[model samples]
Target: MKNSGEELHFRMDLGDSIEAREQSMISFYKRQRVDWTAPLTCTLEGDAAIGDGVKRHCLSSVMSKLQFGFEWKIGAGKTLLFEGEKDHLVPAASQVFVDSDLFVVAGRMIGHSFLHNGPCLTGLSQAVIHVLGGGMPEMASIDIEDCCDTDVREAVELLKGSAELTADQKRSIQSLASGWDLPGVTEENRRWLTEKILFHAVLSRSKGQVKQLRKGLKETQVLDLVTKRPDTLPLLFPRSCAVLYSPQLLLERIIWPAESDSGDETDDTSLEEKCRISGFLREYIENASSQCLQELLKFWHGWEVPPKELYVEVVHGLMPRSSTCMETLRLPSHYISYDAFREALNAAISSVPTGFGLV
Candidate 1:
């Protein structure tokens, strides 16, 4: 019985020793694994607190439970085996760290590109053609396919009416209109084209003295011109007319005169003179009469032995020659805080002469 007890005790001692050796092997392997899998030297802090104590403890506990030669996963279905080489383990750890950051970077780039409003290839091409029409012979001209029928018709009418366009320019425009095949034309496109043609016509006419009529003409006079001779106003005014005349008011009341005051005889005489001038100008424009002769008549009618302020205003407004000049000008927004910029722009505007004369 004693021998039996001794044998049992020996077996138990052997089992305990085997466990101790297994634990020793595991500890040695864990030390080697940590060293091998350490991040790049630049990423390492010499201080131990920079590494989480709880995480290290958990990793060691997991490693101790893992059997030698068994494989385990650390991330996204990637496998790490307990054959335990530092080289293999370090690469896996680096890849896991880099993967998350790479995803974040890629996501941010896509969002930025989506939000960017820089001109696209289509818009760039359109802008080039608009700036340099028919100048680039080698490049295939983009057809004005989106222009509306109304717009095309208006352009044709404007070209026909414009004394500014040379015979050659008129012919070229007509030929372009006849040859061009525009599809899916819209109201907006038509309006856009009409304005564009009118703008070009005004630019062409700007070299002559007739461009002066735009300066200081009251809103009432402008509407009368538009109502009487629609063709001439559109041809002469272009963008400037739009600025001077209100389309909404014109549409609502074709003729709107200013209210008269009964207190002053001078005011009454001035009003009568304006009324006469307005009527005569309307008649002359409607009849397609000569502009030079019409201006001379306007001067004679408004002229006085002693020129009154009203007479001067009338002469300046109706004269064929005026000091007004169109330029690349813009008004600052009301919300802007830059007072200097606003003041500079206003000064430039004021420099333009408001006086007028017959050509």
Candidate 2:
């Protein structure tokens, strides 16, 4: 039965990315005849050309939305979808997510995207990657930082290296532990309790989701590839979300506006400003920190996964703008110095911290 609550179309709302993709996956993923190798075709509801580029954009958009928007909550309504540091994230356990078949959608979506040469889901913890690649849960190395639940973290932190817990503290620790169906915390079982909580929070809770994801990969035939090669897992699910590019590397990716072949009188002056601004940009990127680079990429192409090239344009304006869909970066050609250029670039990226990909 088709889900009538939300209609699936190429011109779907970015905010409704989850619901839209979910409907489409549920409709198609189960069909054994669905060709994973077939090229994806997409178009807006209205008149528009449906091409591979739009298909690429669609896949990229889905995973990015899934990363930040489709998150579950923990204590105080804190998010617990992808836990651990910014660079290293593990899929957090959520009964709500599993029940909703979201993990299944995620797994299938990633496999579909991979078959089409789309984006990889970044920042996955090495521990989860091991299991995705067929490693046993017990042998997989776990970490304290990998736990997303603040309640668990606090309880474990309090119990670790403490001579004794105050009566109130012990009760608090025991209370939360009981919620996860864990036994009472004792001095003798403190280590056992901590390990159990961490494992449960990170893996045991998310086993079903992982299973569904692997099943999706199997349906897409990607699981067979990974199971046989075992080395291709990291390529599909890398550890870091940001790809650090050097100044030279980024500059090389710029597809600078070509000089006019016709002898237009304004061409010479336009080319001069383009050259000057490009120099200014090169200098700024040379000194740019990792955060700045990541932000710039988001501002340029919507996501940190660098495209093969970025189209650059020098426009007659005071601020910079980007069309993520077009992979184009438009800059004002009025800057006189590197410092002015750098300041404006920083301000532009910071202005839309939440939506760097938007114009």
Candidate 3:
């Protein structure tokens, strides 16, 4: 039943108060579903134009989804009703969903950028990861780039000198050299390896080249005669040789020996034999030598031949033929694993003095 005269009536228990009745009425009104505003459609004016142009095509495509709608109340009790076109709401909701999905995808892409190890993306990738992981992106990028550049340069140099390098080395060298020319390398690092360093290394290797130049002079007395001639001495030396010598070509040869001789048998045999003999002698001396040389000398009294031959034999026994055979006899392996190995390595390193080990 409805009450008039600016008051409302309702059936209630005796305990019901005005406040309770008002609250109940308010709750009822809220549940009655009064008309409320719906989302308005974004309008697109003029005829829809489609063209081969990508931008116009996209605009026309998006505008096709634009449609308007409203909300209203109906019946004596005032029930909610949805009115006008509702098609646009689907597109609007879809757009929101697509945007959210895109955001997520973008976030993932940024994350992946950091984890990647490629030359181009690694820096940006790490930066994105750091930011996403709650670190400062800018600072991380700087640090990462610095470390990457250093590593890249070192790797490039190593690969440039490596025996096993392929076409990758050439490509890496080109790439890194280009990077070195970039502003990021800085002027200070630019001076690290200069033309002077190259020149000095060339000069040092000049002696080896002079030896090669004097190879034919072994039978001829030209080298000795030149050494004796005061005026010719300086001229006959590196200063004269430099005119004919190509330091670049020489250095390239020394740096990459593989390019010169793939089947150089003398290089393999002589170097390997000498190394083995030197190693064996060192091991023998280390095992045999006592703190008191005079006491050790007493044992050598009965020895007929020179002790050098015995040393040579011992070297041969320790490092026979190949490194694998040497290993079978318990000679040091290339791959060391422990402190004891390191100590043994130290012993090996110190046992032979320079020139003494030469075959």
Candidate 4:
């Protein structure tokens, strides 16, 4: 490989793999097949046309190899000369890609190195760019901290306007955010913090989980946990609530574990344990972290219950139903059975056409 002025000169020596843009190939020699590939198609699934004159290709099956927007397979003992525009080669060993969305611009990206394949980028402007992150390469380090800060600040702004937050809840969140030394924090740590803040704020108003959050706020240890280690706040809620914060889990189909018919006892049992709700009281508590409570209510209204009655049952279930009679038949008697409460709740939600969503 050689460089002269604005032109780049390279030799595809025997058995070499050279990737260049589809239209960038100026001249080539020897019998080597030059394959044109779609931008980031190797890692991304689904068909998306990148731009004019770009070929449509599927993501390659190979795991370790990177599918550049285009590729050239040079045969053994073949020597080829290629010339194109000047390009800056970002050394993979020293530098890491961070937030490709900010750096990789369509039509501007000639080629990327084979050293890493992060998230696949698409022709769509909103496509996620897999940001490379490892070492600070020359001229690339200045924007990382700034970008992280901006993203975090934007998420915080969203949190402040969230409808679920009570007056006190908003003040509590603000106190934590104010204490966070955003500028002084490391780039990676900032990303983590940003995720935690957004997840907690969004789930703050989740139905089944709100009571737990209030409970935690009252305990000195839990309050300390909330202020100093906000990341663990989701844990104080039920697993059903905590799992909602996980991006990976939420991406899957939304359904309680007991609702699945996969027939895999082990997996089903595991999911049930993670999201166990045996009765109305437990169900209300467990589902507190769900973001789709309204949607879930709609489902219940359509098939399970009338919304107004479901709402009433939920209110009664939350209160303590069991009381010890000072001289009862020497055994505790229940005011409401779990089955009756669940059935009444379901009937209530199903009867309301609009449900209690607005109420």
Q: What's the lDDT for all of these models?
A: 0.27, 0.69, 0.26, 0.26
For residues 1-359, what per-residue lDDT tens digits would candidate 2 score against the true structure? 12233322344333444456445534454454454655455553322324444454556566665556533234554444455675457665667767766666677778877776667787777778889999998888877677777787887788786678889888897787787888887779998888887788788877887887887787678888898988898778866634455677677888876566244555444778888987887788888877687668767775566789988877787788777768888888899888888888888887443233333
What is the C-alpha lDDT profile of model 3 across 241-322, one tens digit per residue?
Answer: 2323222322222211221234644444344444453444344444542322211111121111112211111121222211
Q: Would you give me the overall lDDT of model 4?
A: 0.26
Candidate 4 Cα outliers beyond 4 Å, as residue runs: 1-7, 11-172, 179-359
Name the 10 consecutive residues with the lowest summed lDDT in model 3: 114-123
TM of each candidate vs. truth: 0.17, 0.71, 0.14, 0.17
lDDT for position 104 in model 1: 25
Residue 217 deviation, candidate 2, in Å?
2.3
What is the C-alpha local distance difference test score of candidate 2? 0.69
Q: Which stretches of candidate 3 lie over 4 Å from their true place?
A: 1-186, 189-192, 200-208, 228-230, 233-359
Report the backbone clash tally of model 4.
22
Which residue runs does candidate 2 get wrong by more than 4 Å?
1-33, 45-52, 70-88, 166-187, 245-248, 255-270, 283-303, 308-359
Q: What number of backbone clashes does candidate 3 have, counting pairs of residues 3 or more apart or in separate chains?
A: 4
For candidate 1, which ten residues in a row score worst on lDDT? 5-14
